[model samples]
Target: MIRALAVVLFALLLAGCSPQVETDQARLCRMALPALMADGAAIDILAETPDPDGRGLAVAFSARPSGPVPERHLAACRFREPGRPRESRDLIGLTLDGEALGEARLFALVRYWLATPEGRAADPAPLGDLTRAPVLSRRAAYALQMALDGLPLAAIYALLAAAYSLIYGLIGRINFAFGELAAAGGYGAAMTALALAGLPPAPLLAAAFVMAAAVALGWGFATARCVFIPLRRARGQQTLVATVGLAIFLQELLRVAQGDRASWMTPVLNQPFALARSGDFVAAATPMTFVASGVALGVALALVVVFRWTRAGREWRAYADDPLGAELLGVSPSATTARAFALSGALAGLAGAIMTASYGAVGYALSATLTLKALAAAVVGGIGSLPGAFLGGLVIGAAEAGWSAVFPIDDRDLAVYALLIVFIALRPSGLLGSRDPVVEGLRQSRS
Candidate 1:
């Protein structure tokens, strides 16, 4: 495994060093530079990079003869189609002297540069308004857009939380490696899709899901058998600490195998469905989002039913409620624990596959954040309650989406944890949770 990972990493490093291909933006900038300069002046455009503000390009160039260079020079060129009745209005421009330029400056420069009689005659309306084109009020559309975006994220969180809750409730040990299991599933699906690129989408998708679930299941079983089972006689905290190390090991392994760059999944069910439209403002949901959320909800419901009605689920509940008693009643502890781990991993893998498909990419960095969020959801939803986990995920997702509109992107996680803290302080049982035994015991001890 180490040798295979090393080889993959080496190949990725080689691919990154391969020759660069010129993009359309680069081509446009190159073509427009000559028009912006003096008629016969020799100028060479050397480098162009996106400005930090994302408004325009930062361009570097040197004028020939090496004479006194101006501290600042700005020019814009509006390229027009030669034979078209309707002229093309796209503008490209540069600001020299190590300063970033705005779109407004680019538009203004184009208008001023084209002020000559012939230039004006070629295209009238050179000083087109650069301000935002009029659109319906975004305020009215925010709620719907938030719902469309948040619900899918909520579904993903719920799936992950379910996985966490299942293993923790049954084993009384938190499996920190579950997130890596999900990442493994994502990589599995991505690899399978790449391997079977010639297959039709339906079959390919089905195969990818199977591959993802199988990979995660195997990992979960091995983790239980090799790690947790061996430490079964030890304290739960010891097993938890071991799982943390295991999580780190798995993450590093994936980083080596998959490389640092994100792996993009095939675009499946990604067509956008516009929910509401008023002028330029629109609320939309992609088919991918809907499909993923639907699958997550269906899976959650199915699991709920299985736990409530099935014999295997009864065995699981029996083990969770009282492992010693269950073992005495002829339930195989190792088999039950393995089954729990497998189911949890399968759910996590399914979630990962759907999430990667919806977002179109997966990376090693995603594992830690996803695990944290799912763990938070489980705790907030009353850790052992399946319905509560789903509800908690929705709450977290909605809170994040809504708060992002008001706060900086970097502060969004703070809002989630703050909410969790508030909930814990006020009601340790969570929204749907019964009184927590740990908290109750503490209170009784204090009394």
Candidate 2:
């Protein structure tokens, strides 16, 4: 494992030598084809032409004919700037390359591409023949491809879920602020990457994670000292409310520090490497994915080992199982709770850094959504079950990825929520949970 990790780290170090800062051209290509005249979903005849200068993409689409006269449906996201590759970009220009094209010019350009003998498809068809392979190669490739793409997401979620489980078990209250801590961690990693741009790739990447975790640990310590410790004797609802407030406060702090919009960075070690090959398709992941996965899993494994075998782990488990019983048995509730906060916070922070490295974007707004998802993952896996948390994260991440490909993109979030509801209704104890946590807690209280 160490040898394989060394290889992945070495490769990443080499990748940092290149222009890790993704250019506008690379960003455009990252989202879609540089230049493509393909059929689209909403627009009948869709085409995209890239600006050679790396400015943006010009899109043109003609609506399918409703009658003898063709209707010109309004095309959304026809022109997209490199800055906002996902959103439609409309600009007034006539550059040599298609930096930005107005409606008329876009339509004209599409006509020129499709009408001209040089660019247009021959044989009396606007679209050239697209053949399907008999092996179901594309479908198989797609499923595997989604699984591969989801690996990093899974790693991040796994870490987050583990953190949630740790805190929930230790204190019997959820740390709603974990998602904010993750966002902060990502920001820390990004800032570190920018500052240490002169360093070698491997060191830079390592420093980023270290700094991110350190920062998060520091914050976690602060929250423990100021918020959690003071309320150690309080009820779960009070602690839960306190954490929610902390989450909100952290979000505002991060937003003020980083700003409203998501800060983008050049991808680190994002150059894709092939995982598997089908007839014409290849599933791939970057060196960073390997690095991220290794690091996240290592952290998780280490945590699990500590929880299972260490003296500290035993004490904490004792407290979580029965606070009064543990207090009577010589365990200090104060110390155990404090350590749990620090450890859980650090885990969440590392997950954020992984997100930044893998996705190349981070913002304060990510906190709420991430918290909800990770919480759902924790619940689905058995909220207080350490190992189950990691497993749940893997399941949730893969589910999101699979749903995106198999179903309409719009309904993806809904699916996760639905799954959460199903798990709660059918099996409140979760996969690894031996009994329903609520019922168990009540029984313990009575005893």
Leading candidate by TM-score: 2
TM for candidate 1 is 0.67
Model 2 Cα shift for residue 357 (angstroms) = 0.9
Would you list the C-alpha lDDT of every candidate in the order shown? 0.69, 0.71
Q: What TM-score would every model get versus the actual structure?
A: 0.67, 0.71
lDDT per residue as tens, model 1, 227-293: 8777867842687789999999999999999899899875654535466655555677665677677
Q: Which consecutive 10 residues in model 2 have the weakest lDDT in total?
A: 121-130
Error of 2 at 338 (Å): 0.9
Q: What does candidate 2 score on TM?
A: 0.71
Among residues 3 or more apart in sequence or in different chains, the pairs in candidate 1 whose N, CA or C atoms overlap within 3 Å are none
lDDT of 2: 0.71
Model 2 residue runs over 4 Å out of place are 1-136, 436-439, 442-447
